[model samples]
Target: MKQTGAIVSVADVAWIIALWVNRSIHSSMKTLKWLLNLDFEQQMNETEKIKRAKQIAIIAGVFTAFVGVLLLLNYLQIKKSDPLNSLVLEKLVERLSSEPNNQQFVEEIRQVDLLMRKAYFTSLWQVRTGAYLMLLGAIVLVLSLRVYYGLRFAIDQPSADQIKEKKKRQLTQRWIGISGALVIILAIMSAFFTMNHLRSYEPEKMIVHSKAGDESIEQLEIVSIRTSETEIDTVIITESTDVEVKQPEVAITQQPEMVVFNEETVKINHNAFRGSWGNAVSSSTNLPTSWDGATGKNILWKTELPIHGYNSPVIWNEKLFLSSANTSKRVVYCYDRNSGKLLWEREVNNIQGSPATQPKTTEDTGLAAPTLTVDGEKVFAIFGNGDIIAFDLNGNRVWAINLGVPDNHYGHSSSLLTWEKKLFIQYDTHSGSKVMALSTETGKTIWETVRTNDVSWASPILAKVDGKFQLIMLANPNLSGYDINTGKQLWSVDCMSGEVGPSPVYGGGLVYATNEYARMVAVNPKTGEKVWEDNYYLPEVSSPAYHNRYIYIATTFAVVACFEAATGKFLWEFDAKNSFYSSPMIAEGKVWVFDTGGKAYIFESGSEPKLISSPELGEKVFATPVFADGRVYIRGVKHLYCIGVN
Candidate 1:
């Protein structure tokens, strides 16, 4: 009996130890599962569970506080490095506010403004990202604390009815999760619709030009505003006097490449377009009439220029010369004709009239608005400050002369033209305007004819009229002709009025002159009398080009109008869909019209205006293209392009 009692006691002790071991294993399994999904199950003692819950709450609080500190640091960093402090933005705004009429300045301001705003918004998004991360961490930490406390010290004992109630509560929680997900989905859809609705532009607001006095200029303002959920795009045009505001074309479409013919070799003509009245008929039979810049077809080479200018390039033999200037410096550039490589550049630093001393010029009438003239022996260039500098064939400065600061309100823009061995310059300022002929070799004043002229930007043309070479020029009140050899006034007429920008084109024994706010008149160059006058469409800046009896004018309003040279009859016209600043050139039985937005439109100059092809260079073009030596040279705001095939 005694042995049995001892064995029973041992078995009882073994059972107690086994029960303790099983309890520990079950507790560890429950703790591991709870850590994996944060869903602890199984009954626990009150004091121990409370202690565990307190530890979890402390850890969660610490974690949430740490995340909050990180979020705060991110916000402070973003504020410290704000985009408003950028130097580029300051410079752009300064220039934009000063030159209110400069389109290039406005464009640069818009681009920089966009980039800065993007950076600002990107910083904001980064802060938001940190905020989101912090919120998630806080939510997780808060839930962990709440659950830890709620489950701790709860009663483990329950009846059958209590169990049923618990199951119902679990079912409700499942439904709540499902509803929360649906709400999140609905919120996302709403935000997407809101974004799309906000990303749209209203119609443009156009302001009509005020009808002021004849000498009074009117300021017109046009604004385009587009709103999006994330940003706003606003374009403002503040100052415009005679400009007619039209919306730019909506799209730039890509076209197929046009084949450039090169089967036959083309002969180089040095004197082609040497004068303003560039060969009325092109001798380039194999030149490309149509090209696509986007496809890189027939574009032999393009070289980036260093300065800004409205001066067209001049070609002589195998060299190309161009002039450019800014507020402080002037540069004359030379390039190789075949390779489009810049051979040399010379800078003339002895600028007489400081840019500030000169009167305010229109955006188009920049420091270098006049086209360079070359006579194989020498190249000549003129600036808005009445500075004329001559260079040799190898880009060496030959002579420099300052005619004195011009008093014109719109700056000096008369281009240089050469006749025989004399360089012709029409210095028509507000006062003391004169037409001077300088010797090409020594840059000496060969002949000077002072005239009673107003502030005019007209460049003189050397043409053979009535069996004599006459230099024709136009001003506000009169159109005059001078002898090319002696600077003698051959004839003068009080026929033209308004700011004369269009240089008179002499063809068919008549000189065609037109302006924005004046009548289109056909005058006899010999007698300087109005032969015929028409009140039809006219150009603002672009000069009229003539081919026999057909006269072509591409206006700033983007219309290419044709007229009969003899009778002043209006012919057909075509819309280029963009404004034109560069004058039209007649070449190869086609009329080339280059727009300010860098598009070239070629069409037939005849009774009917037929469409050929429109090529875009993706750059701003303000100078007329030079066609010589079987190649076409174009000057953009930043680059010079030579288009031809070898």
Candidate 2:
């Protein structure tokens, strides 16, 4: 009996020791699984893990294969160059160039060009987006695949066979990585290969006339300079204007890339805002003294504009440029100066940072109130939304930039000025005022100067005094002058008041700044001294025109006033039947003024205001009359009419 009890006690002790050893082994295995981040297997039963791993492996494999196929397709697409370039675009551009007066062909070309640009840019954006998605999908696929493979062999013992399987898995991963890297390389190369390289525009050799009555021929290149992200066809590169320039007291760093502009601005016959150089006068002495729009007498042509805008027209090298916009879209139009036929029109869009919605604007200053200005190369237009863009002479987009939504009570109606290779703008608002100069080559800012006034709807004019060019700006009560190249304020005088709308005119050794119900003052630009002051008839919108030795003023009221250029002595004053918004333009020794009722009052540019003819245009006219090539181009509510005897 004693021997049997001792044996039983020993057996019980052994059984307890065996249970403890088993529990300790399970605890150590759980700790190992947690440390290795294999906790999914620890949380799930054997059957559940097997089912989950199978689902994960199939889904990940299918997704990875699908992404790979997409990448391959995208790569093939990028390898193929733009179909638009080889298709009908080149022929269209050539045909339009030959038949420049064909309005229908011009419209067709515009439509096709818009479509081609949209398609090309969309594809580029797609390729960039797909690359990032492919990389992310590849990473997810590898991780899920590893988890699935480990779960499949969870119950197996470690041996030579398992080690061999691990090596094989690593080999498969290495091949996958290599394939991915190769695809990336091919895609990068294709992106470069598929860039847009449209046919460049080669302008005809220009004939330059010298002061000594000599003629010379010069060749210029208007080539295509491609940008990677949003590449356009070509650009007319000019780094500065042809005006006189002086360095500022403070230094400004210019971009390393600069281009030259061979401009002969002295022989100025072009028509921009205030006519040539904002002077509002032409040297031609053979203009038609008689025209009747109501009777269609001496009216050369009348073409209906697509949209109505308050902005005036600019003429350069027999091409007319202007901009018009409604709430939905903004567009620039180029017309044949002789035939009054539409040459081309391009909508301004795809500009980065452009507002999706336009700001609030009044009816007087509509969305496209600001006039377009053209250098011999590029034509620039700005809208009330502050979107400034330049188009080549052929109407292709060169560069675009947004000046942000202007804080103007009426609307942003500041006209553009192009000098040398630089573009100037007077950005005055109710909040603050600034004068900015942008590079015509890349639309980059060359210099900026801030002003201390607020809320002026007037435009800046470029003036030359003492052989140096200065930018004259009218803001609120102060008229200021700035250095064009350096954007430094030279001088300012408090000579204006009220809502200044009429742009300043510089002539007769003085700068003319005017406002309604305020004094129309002329000041010496060099000394900032008031040369003369006339309060008899101040114009609200009509900027004074200087011709010969007389100053012409057309007020919003039914008044026409003439003043002596040397003195502010009132030469003569007369009140017509209609109000005038269109400024008086001096051409061929005649004063041409269009009223709001669309009646043009032609008078003599002498000390005595002798009325030549008050012809009715039969429509409302607000834009200033543009004199080009011995013709008067006027913009009515819905028509652009050429009034001259051919």
Candidate 3:
């Protein structure tokens, strides 16, 4: 099939050759008939034959010249502007990449691309058909010219002047033959050049290489280190430079022993941004009620992070994972869960097309606002610059790829989510919002679905509601649910607005979503119907948590509010002088909410607000706390502090 397509790539040339071959055979048959004395130049009407031959030659020559000129114009048109490789398309794609959120440009590119593609195939068709007509005209012109000249050159009586005329005719014939050979040679060369040029433009391959520039990954360098007698698993990092690389990639490194390692039982061990299923609730018990960072009360350990980030920490059984970044480097840090000692920190280098300079971002949503996800055997980290890297338990770099620099006002803060072997990425831009599922082991795209939602800062949630798993997402204008296995959107409630920073929560047989300036609504996950909605005490940055029959929200306006999950009734709100950014988490029937001033407000889970204790963790807090093995892991503004029964 490919070979056949290649032949058609130079369709005009192929058509000309085939038609000429047929004409040549016909001319040979006519010559054979004349040689057998079937027709002796029609000597009965000599003058008439000469006149008719002259007229035929003149008409054929004019027609052949016209088609020849037309074909030259067509060739120049193709050579000057290949529709697939048009400058217009290139510029449009470039603008679309930089301004991905611009719907106008996105639509324009898609429309123009469709037109150019139609023009491409149309030009190919015209080339084949027009070239065939031009060749036929040329052949007729040649045959008529032969008939006219042969009649004129005929000499019945042998004469010196006649002999001179014959010699002159022979010289003309020699020059014509040479010219014809040269024309054929040039046509053959042009055909092969064109065939080679159009090889990459396969007709079936549509949508010009992802909207983001081609990911060109030249090579990977894997490096490993060992502090103790564990496997020196190598984490591969790539160097992104001005050098050209193509397309996104995620390569996996096999384990040394290839053991069947699955952390199915350790999911609730603080695996994702919230918990195993994106709900900020844990089943662990005996959590500390109070702690003082300044006095070291109930503080298990404190480690100063190398750099600050807004992303929360994720924990496995014995290893805690977090990521941090600056303008020059994006690094993933792993620490020992027991001692809070830094086990290893590897700079994620060599991503094919990671942005050299960071995009303009608000301080609130720093470069590392998205928290890491540890799916049993391997841990994954994604930065605001659209760089996602995965590493094994022993710090071996599994795979990494740049999702292209996102187009966002506050930067891409949507964290990563994992369910089983599939990883979900919710990339919401102004007009280019979409969801993508990728293989956790290989980083290959499993499915991608374009969305019509507004720009969103909220991450996604994979929740089990109505005895079925669904991927829930919060974006402006809608709270949507999608099938976890496939990316098909199940249901959507168009009741959200503003920046929609808070991720949706599932509780009380409903999903709750809210924004700062918008209303909070609880929707039925199965039917997409709103069960209840409240207009007051909305959250800006902090995600809400559900405990028992109440929904707790920590707002930026110095308040931790609670309401009934089943109804829109407001239970109570804890007013304070400080604002809140960290989300609230539920553990052991207690609601733990943190303020920006590093104060923790613990409340008993009930209809009414019961403030149990207000603890202080010294430094400011932005990332939500993670609970693992009864200890609360808080990613403070400058340090990772563990609160437990110390």
Candidate 4:
């Protein structure tokens, strides 16, 4: 059947070509029949034949001249305005580098460039083609004028035979005129087909390129040192060091022996801002009950940061990681948690393009809005440009990959999370929203679930319900839950609206969802049912925190409110000193909320509005503070401060 179809297609194409050729031959024969006739002198007198030939030539020459002039003018217009420029070519190169593994993109780029070059050459040659046609028409007109004059100057007059030939000559002129019009029409049809063929070379879609202009990177170099060696093991320190020549290695023993390496297991504290659910707060431990950054009452150390971002810091072991970026560069900063000293800085080049190739952003949303994730082994960070990079504890880059440019309107703010060695990235965009699970050891995707949401800023939180772990997130008009291991939608409910910023908080057999201009709904994860919803005092930016039977919320306008977890009942509202962008945190029977004006408000967690103490940290704060051990790490616009009693 396939072979039959192939044969049939070839036969059809051959028939089309043959038909066009036959038409062209017939038209040509009719156009030049009078000139090729050998018996013209016997059939018609010279005077009569000349008169008829001049009329035919004059009409054909005028028609051909008009076509030639039209083609010449079109060619000149094309030369004046060409679309291919350096900027356009540069964008194509950038798009090529973005997805080097995509073969389709590579082929499309090649075809686009080839077509553009072909168009330039075709327009240039059209000028010469038109000029040649004009010259031919001019020669024909001159010959017609010569024939008219020679016939009129003859002295001998014609007889009755000449009078009869004059009528025949006039009839032949009508046939030639009909043939000339058809010839001109055929030329136009051929040109039309040629242009149609050229149009087939257009790309499937326009590919725009972006640049990370004037960006400078600071690549951190790390060195390893073997400090001591025992009989069976060695201790090594992975730290940043300068370039220095090393001595030759010396063997400790010459005899071959069996060695048993001891495997040690260490327990890590929940210190980082693990997803949107917040770090596990200790109920009985002694964290700082009160602190003041302006008076230096409990401020341990403050280190200034060069870059600016709203991304919160993540802590693993003894290091605190935070990501920041400008329009040109994205940077990850690692600092010593105890001393607030800068340990190492790693930078990645950024390309800023939004839903379209135009850089879409607002003053509030920046490049590094997503918080970093540290899963004990590697620290992962993602930028608005769809770059996901991972690094080990020693500041060495593990792997990097671009998840295709996101189509978010106000930058991507979906924070990353990890469960059982799989990195979960909530990549919700305006056009192609997906939940991807990647292998932590290698930056390879394990499974991906496409979503129908449009442009959400909420991050996903890991929740355990009905003896299985589920990833819960707030999307446009819905609060959905998915299986953590497999990208399967376990449950979802329509309970959210507007641009979602506050991630869902899971507790007490219910998950609470909130947004800027939407109702706050508490959803049951098992059945995907909305328990209760309220529209009063909805948070625009800050996420809700659940403690005991109450939920705490900090509005964007600096009003701190608490509500009943099970029922949609408003508890109380307090006016915070400044506006809040950071989410509220509950730890040790107190609710901690940071405002935009560098102030931290501490209050008792209850239905009544009671303000305990408001401490002012001199710098502007946009990130949520991390509380672990005895220190609270707050990431300000210009610094990362460790507030603890020394």
Candidate 5:
């Protein structure tokens, strides 16, 4: 077992020795006074006094020797039972077994091990305060004894002057030692605080300005504009005060009008067809309304999905895969991406629990929230019940495993990620969450690490930092990184405070993460150190999408904010008419975001954004958009839209 607490450690032996030395000196002084005041002038010989002095010195020497040995033993015990080394050994065994041929893997493992040891060792200094208190108590006890004995025995002695002077000197030395020790202790604490603060650096300040001019800022007026196909009108009103202005009237002039014959006309424009959805504050790709026969729009064969699902489709080669579930059955469906035809469906009765009132209670509530991932040969999907199923490209079941029963207030929402031969998933719930890694070939557990706090809806992402790969998860109260091979926690930064939803995005050498009630944070992924944090509250379910050097975040309050990825700086904000749950997807230099009201808003994916188009599908949408082979597939509550050039 590791060290129980910081208190009562091996290094305390030095403190004990110092206390013993002080007590011995005081005892020696007391013994000398007793010997001198025993009528020694008339009855005692010179040799007797010399013998008593020698005895007192011998006693002090023996006491000091005993304290020195105790101190040595304590140090030896601490070295032998170091808990940091033991934990490192456990992690090293797992890493070696997973990647036996990696050249620098062993060295990287050693470095991580050393860092953990240092952290634990540094914690020991916090216990030093208790040791100092013990030393102080010992000093006080020694001084009290010395003062009482000196006054009691030397009341009528002729050499009292000499004894008093010696006492005074000892008192002065004691005060100096106490003061110096306190100063050293405080200095050590201050240095530790300063170093820790410097390591966690904050970014520079940001300034935002309002659109209205300074003269009109005091009485800021909001104008509402209504438009039709032929005309546009605007109206303005102020709540604080009202002012009336005169309107100019002009006489109408009569002009000759020409009569036109009605004819059917077809107008086609590439740029005019791109529309936007979700909260239209962010930018998206321009989707074509039609495409050519082989790879484009209206000419290709189309097919319908077997059942309703919120999960987006995954396409590989010409085949498409998706997961879905109904009241009595859970299934994996395979389809043809070009023809939109269902090829095969695999159904199973894997669910065994009753549904709760909340929409996110179980995987059966919706089989398709967690999208399926393909690693060329096999397709993988994770159910809310912790069921992980794998299927080959030809629709054959390869393997399956259930991690655990996820009992979250809102069911499991994490998607599965694969690295090499391992499948990683974050299973954070109310009943104690954990990040688990499994062998992809057999679905056997590799390693599992318990999360520090409860998690709700966030997913984990794999990120490479400083040439090392780490699996990062945004759990409640913190963003944690773990060794991808061994599931050992490498580093954790406490930046998120509320329910975390956004899957972490890694770009530009920094890992970006945000929580529903907390702010967005950027950190150096390798060291798990915070670079900057901005107090921007977003929705509980929306995830940030990154493109170039910008990040687009959609809040539940119907606002989409664009931010610079490396530094936590807000660039622009857009106001959509409805709240958002669907995440934004970036493609073709634009952002496509869908809202619950079935409106798709397309925006320019740059610093200065402009609205491209707005199209209404007249349905509710909860899933994000997916793009493949120049076609965008959006799943609505009642229909799946295939947008491309016609």
Candidate 6:
């Protein structure tokens, strides 16, 4: 069957080539007759001129025939090896061999056979169009040759009037050639531009949910040790099963108590202090400001440190723990929160193939982008390479686990969150992305759910939907919900554009997620139904912070917008002088926003906007400021500032 089709295609191509050659021969004959009628040609012998014209016509015809044969052979080869034809033949054979009474099977086979035939014809049409183009070029070449020989004959023995007319015709041909070239060039460039534009336009879609119940849980032993210069090493080894409680009680009651003390009653004092980066879970409150210096009356001491990072300082008692990294080295530094003095600095080994950042992102952007989460007994830090390290409050190394590589083209920015005895850290990337839970004590896998697409800069947020705990992950084209215990996909809503960048904020029963291409969407966490979507116009990389009835979103374009959390309605937008990459922190009746240019802007968190202060430090800043102990900790490119009234 294939051989038969090949022979037919060759015959068709041969016919087309023959028709093109016939038309060219006729046009060339007319030109030859005109050359003979010229007065200049009267000087030449009539027989000689006729003989030359016949020879030229024969040569043109022979060359055209040769080209036609080549085209026929090429078409035959293409038809013989076509995949579409093979598929069509296979389907036809299957249909003929089927049972006579099986009407439905016959129809299915017939449809497949029809589609294959259509595809084969379409492929053949494309080849025919290419051949047509060649035929057109051949026709133009034959015409040009006749004109060249006719003009040469006239030029060799021509009248003065003939020479003048020939010059005019040559000038016209030059313009035609130039115009044709320009048209072809423009068509090629237009096609390239259209393809480039299409590649950049990505459609917004819902997040995909993965099936759960496939993960294999493992048990691992964990050991904690306290080493001192004078005393022997104090080691504590606990059994994996005995220590692994279903739920840790420490997480439930650790929420800080909300105090309703008046501004005047709060006392302000500062002194040198030291502590580890233990978990200091503060209670959730709607108070605009929680700091003692809200009235600008209480004066507290301030200090600065040398390293800068995006990780928020975890303060336990007096000492502060934070991580910092540049292109060359990554360091975890301990600082005295009160005196602003460096206590001890430990350098972590750099992992190979880590994401590289521009110079502007050096401070807060590095392999140590995620903030450390502590559980009082040990401080845990997640590196860009998915390495989680644990240390005691006194800077003693506990245990380290290297979770597989993450899928982040920009870098891993998801911070660690602890729920009872489980440490939840999401590792979503361009390749092999998954969200996994680990035992906080033993570092053993609890449950893991693989994701379909890459979530470059977004972080997972834990939310309770309809009284059931679920893991909400912002991924490519969708917002996913997973069962907290079993890692099962509950539901997913498509409401994302471009790369997911913002960590989803849960408030008023809705999950707010934003992307770099400036799409903000709110969806019900339980049902995965979109509440509303707003185009911010400006790119948003920072997560939205919710307080009271409003959610604050900071964009990299230096604009901060406050929207009603329920309806996604814009309340007010503020355009600061510096671009904002840091998430806004609401405290003490104010919204604290740190900019990339090292300026911190404090504004009233209400309908009527009021700027409190925009303090400039002489360096760039990337990390958001954390308000604690009557002061704000601001991390700049070169130094970490403890900002407060002097």
Superposed by TM-score, candidate 6 places the C-alpha of residue 178 at a distance from the truth, in angstroms, of 70
Estimate, for each residue in 1-646, the C-alpha lDDT of model 5 and write its tens digit: 3352342443454555656665665666675666657576774565555555665555544443443344334334445554454555666646655655443554456566566556445434433433343344334434444544454455556477867987897798689657645644454444344234322222221122324332111122222222221121111111111111112122324453342211110001010001111111222245453333234334334444556766666555566677876545568887766667777676643322223322346532364566666655567787666667777666666666555567766566776666666777788888787776766665655565666667657767766677777888887787877778666677778888776766777767778788776788888877678998887656667777777888887777888788887787788888887877778766667777777776677777777667686566556777776665456666666555566655
| Per-residue lDDT of candidate 2, residues 389-472 (tens digit) | 888777667788787789988889888888888888889888777788888766866776667787787888888889888999
Name the runs in model 4 displaced over 4 angstroms: 1-284, 350-358
Local accuracy of candidate 3 as per-residue lDDT tens digits, 1-646: 2322333356556446545654554554354334334465664365666676666656555554544454455556567667667677689767766765554665566567677766666655555555566566566667766776776666366489978987887899789757754654454344344445567643334323443353421123333323232223232222222222223233435455443324455455888888767888887777888889989999999999988789999987788999998778889999998899898788888776677788888888878999888777789888888888888777877788777788899988898888768888999986478887777877766566667778899989877776778999999898988777656677878898888899988876889899999999999988888888898899899898987788999888999898988887998888965898888998888888788998888888887778899989999988888887668889998899888997
Candidate 4 TM-score to native: 0.60
Q: Which stretches of candidate 5 lie over 4 Å from their true place?
A: 1-306, 350-367
Would you give me the overall lDDT of model 3? 0.75
Q: Which ten residues in a row have the lowest lDDT in candidate 4?
A: 234-243
- Residue-pair clashes per prediction, in order, are 0, 7, 9, 0, 24, 16
Q: Mind sharing the TM-score for model 1?
A: 0.57
Model 2 lDDT at residue 276 = 69
Which pairs of residues collide in model 4?
none
lDDT of 6 by residue, 107-146 (tens): 4554664555554454455345434544454454455456
| Candidate closest to the true structure, highest lDDT | 3
lDDT of prediction 5: 0.58
- Whole-model Cα lDDT of every candidate shown, in order: 0.65, 0.72, 0.75, 0.67, 0.58, 0.58
Error of 4 at 191 (Å): 32
